[model samples]
Target chain A: MKLLESVGRIVAISRKEIRQLRRDRLTFGMVVAIPIVQLVLFGYAINEDVRHLRAAAVDYANTQNSRLLLADAHASQVIDLVRKASSAEELEEWLRRGEIRVGIVIPADYERRLEDRKRHGRSARPLAQILVDASDPATYGSVAGLLNLPPPERPGIQPPRWRYGSAISGVSNPPPTFEARPFYNPERRSAVHIVPGLVGVILTMTMVLFTSVAIVRERERGSLELLITTPMKPVELMVGKILPYVLIGLIQVGLVLGVGALIFRVPLRATPQDTIVAALVFITASLTLGLLISTIAKTQFQAFQLTFFSFLPQMLLSGFMFPFDAMPRPAQWIAELMPLTHFLRVIRGILLRGARVVEMRHEIWPLAVFALVMLTLAAGRFRKRLD
Target chain B: MSESAEQVIRSQGLTRRFGSLVAVDHVDLEVPKASVYGFLGPNGSGKTTTIRMLCGLLEPSEGKAQVLGLEVPKEAEGLRRRVGYMTQRFSLFEDLSVFENLDFLGEIHSLKASHRRSRIDTLLERYRLADRRKQRAGTLSGGQKQRLALAAAVLHEPELLFLDEPTSAVDPENRRDFWESIFQLADEGTTVLCSTHYMEEAERCHLLAILDHGKLVANGTPQQLMDDVDATVVEIQTEDPRRVREQLAGMTGLLSLAQLGNRLRLLLHREVENPVWQVEEELDIDAGATVQVVRPNLEDVFVVVTRDEVS
Candidate 1:
């Protein structure tokens, strides 16, 4: 009988909290409406693929060999032959002005070296260089590797089989070669990589922002006096207060997923049910974190400051905008403690790679543990009466 | 209500200490069933602390207190369901409508749906808040908000109600209506323990416990407390009332002097030989100035009681 009464009180209090949430237009919009808009923006707008890089070719040799090599580079989808510069100066200028990512320079002696090698019974090495702008390290690194590979072997050519045929017309006729193949991100769009993590970032920000402020507002308004006087247990009150935010978090995830599929054309790699369950877990963990923040904060302003402080580290360290592996070791270790790290991994795996629950159990267990510890501490701190 | 029945609230040597300061000292108080007990004190007089202890919100440091026949701190949770408490401020959920606030509290009290609906409707009608039932609590005027808070507190019809200065900010006319409701509740056999700074409101209680500096200096009916002071109050209108006030302060027989508009009311422990004649002979006054002796009120008793406590 006593338990029934306590549960009833908790429910009553939770109902009142839900009413207050609905009444607040700004909080409701931020917690529920903004996530949908963010999901759409992230899913459709961000692209990570780095294909179709513009390149300027300086063919000083003026030979058929240089022309054929240029044609082959143009035939491939990775590089676009934007301009034919007659001098290396023009090529360097284009690279500095950000007009081109890679520049190919064919030396004047390139066709003459091949002809001499054909007559002397020795293989010749070309002197042409692929100059790349190293400012964007990741993109420039891949382009440089593509430029350095050995030429493809001719058809029906056995291993270690080559002939210096005098019929190779004036060093213009070069051997055939194979095309470069790019795996995974064929287009190298940043959106494809970032959208998956954006889902996690958006949900984390919204759930934490609202849950952190709700309890402190009651304390400031003195409504906490009325609530604490009732027979409701601390955990019961916390859970009841958090249920609405969890539901809203799910709604936001669904809205964003819909926009991603319809507007951004991001594929629904996983089933809707799986994606929702993952998002629910993420929100539950984040809500507990919010409660933890409320436990230590004295007012809404203090809560805002603490929340932003925590959020900045998570955003920078979680590799949402930067590569985690490339970050300094100390920074990477710091990111490991933030729940957003696990959440981003889970969301990206499920949304982009279509990971299953068993595959995501590693991420799920940590979140569950974090939620448990935070919720327990928060309940103890936010008892019916102040300690 | 049988005389042999246990008091609704009984405490022996109840004390709550905050660090070195004793907020509620070793004070014992008994609240009879169906009686309106008023705790009268100025600000910081331990009235709020005592009320909090009685309502099971705070634990006493060195005393035993029973609320509604249940030992406090042990049966606090169980007793909470039976006691309704209204804080000094209107602490209702501001975002909810009047009907919703009442219904929510009713639900917490575990009132059945049918019973809750009828109780809310009846409360609205009785409080004359039915027309504004749909208005948000934040939108209500101060008086209406107080009415709503009271309505919500009594929704469960708890056996005991603790109202901590419920009418401090309320207008005089509304205060009268609120006291009428309290009296009506007592008539229905519900125990009430309220605290207030307004002596007139304190005068309405069946019993008054005057606390000073965390101690209960006096406890009795309003008339009995006034009679306990045993002084005569004389209202004097003099041309130089300020001089009279100063001269009156040095008199041993005079208890207190309260300014009333352009005149001063002098309280005397005894009616000396022609005191008004003595005042008129010594102090200058216009011919139209009049002097009259009147009965004492609650404020006079309060002044004497608190003054005795200070000295």
Candidate 2:
């Protein structure tokens, strides 16, 4: 009988909150519209695997071998040969002016070396050099690797091979070959990586901002007095006040995830149950944090300031826009304290790595513990008395 | 009502202090059932503070209070369902419609669905809000909002109702209508403890307590308070009442002087000997001027009680 009464009061409060939310058309629109707009805007704009970098080729060889090598580099699609330079100095000027990411130079004796190696077949070596702008790591890293791919196989041309001796003599020589094959996102689509992390960021922004003003608005408007005078307990009021916003948070998640899958073609690799559980835990943590903020704030304006104060730190330290491991040691420790850091890991792990729940224990348990701690603290901070 | 029944609310030296400021001092009250008890005071006189303590919305810094026979601060949760509180401000959910507001209150009070619906309908009709049931409380006029707040407060038919300055925003006509509704509830054996700064409203209550700077200076029936006033009231009608007021301003043994058109009402200290003669002598009586002693009203009692505390 006692439990039923508590349920009844919670339902009553939740019903009132839902009505209030409906009446506030702008807030309701923000919940659904902001996530979709942010998802589409951020998902399509960020690119990690930069391609089609401009290049200047100074081919002093003027030979078919140099032309065929340049054509092979061009066909790889990593660099676009925009201009031909007469000297290495001119190529260096183009690279300095940011006109091109790579520059290739061939000596005038390049064909003589190949022909001599073909004849002597023993001691001759071919020398070809490439100049590259190593400034932007993301842009230069991929382009430089593509520029160094194994020389194309030519008809009547034998590629160099190192001679190996018998094992009994303890002498061995092997050819040097470097190859890189990226997994998970073989194409390196930025949206596939960014969209999963966006689920956490969007949920944190909306859930914390929306729930932070719930109780403080009531207190400012005097409805809190009416609520306290009723048979509603503090815990019941807190739960009921946040339950409607939790549903709104779920709707936001669905909208963002649906848009992510349909528009960005980001895979949903995790099981539905795992995704739902992670989302629930994250949303609960955010809402409880907001409730705690409301209890500390005396007005709606203070609540807003407090929400933004926490929001900025979460956005910077949660590994959504920057890599967590790249930050300094102190910053990484601070990031560890943020629930969004763990939530981002769970979401990205599930969506990108196809991580099962058993494999995501580290992320899931911390998120659950964060939600539990925040809920207990919020309940403790919310007092029944007006004073 | 039986004479041996317990008082609906009883307090002994109930006090609340905020740092160095005392918002509600040692106030002892015994409010019996089925009576309209009015708390009259000026702004910041702790009327709202006392009401909050009674409603279990605040904790007193010192002393004890038993509301509806339950020890406050200890049994406040049990006392919640039995009491209804209407704050000085319009505290209803403004975004909700009239019917929705009342329905929410009924549900929070744990009323069954069938009972909630019927009670809400009756309240809407009684409060003359049936036509505006679909209107948002925020969009309602001041008088309409007050009626809606009252309807929400009484939706559960609580045994005790605390209205803190309930009609401060309404006009006189609406205030009269509101008092009529309050009286109707009292007639149905509900105990009412309301706070107001209006003297006429206090005059209508069965019992009145006057607070000044967190102290309960006076408590009694309106008639008893008037009879027990420590000053005598004298009305003087003259061709120029302002001149009479000016002349009486610096006079000794004078408590307060108020002018109503061409008549001047003076409250003199009780130790004065023949105030009419004293006033006439001081103002230089003329043949056309008339002076006579009259019965004291609640305002005179208020001025006399609070005037000394101000100094």
Q: Per model, how much of the real contact set is kept?
A: 0.56, 0.95
Task: Please report how far candidate 2 places residue A265 from its true position, in Å.
Answer: 2.4
lDDT of 2 at A57: 88
Q: Compose the digit string of candidate 1's lDDT tens values, residues B109-146.
A: 78889999998999999998999999999999888999
True contacts kept of 1: 0.56
The DockQ-based CAPRI class assigned to model 2 is medium
Candidate that would win on lDDT: 2
Off by over 4 Å in 2: A44-177, B1-4, B286-288
Which 10 consecutive residues of model 1 chain A have the lowest summed lDDT?
Answer: A175-184
Indicate which candidate wins on DockQ. Answer: 2
Candidate 2, B6: how far from true, in Å?
Answer: 3.1
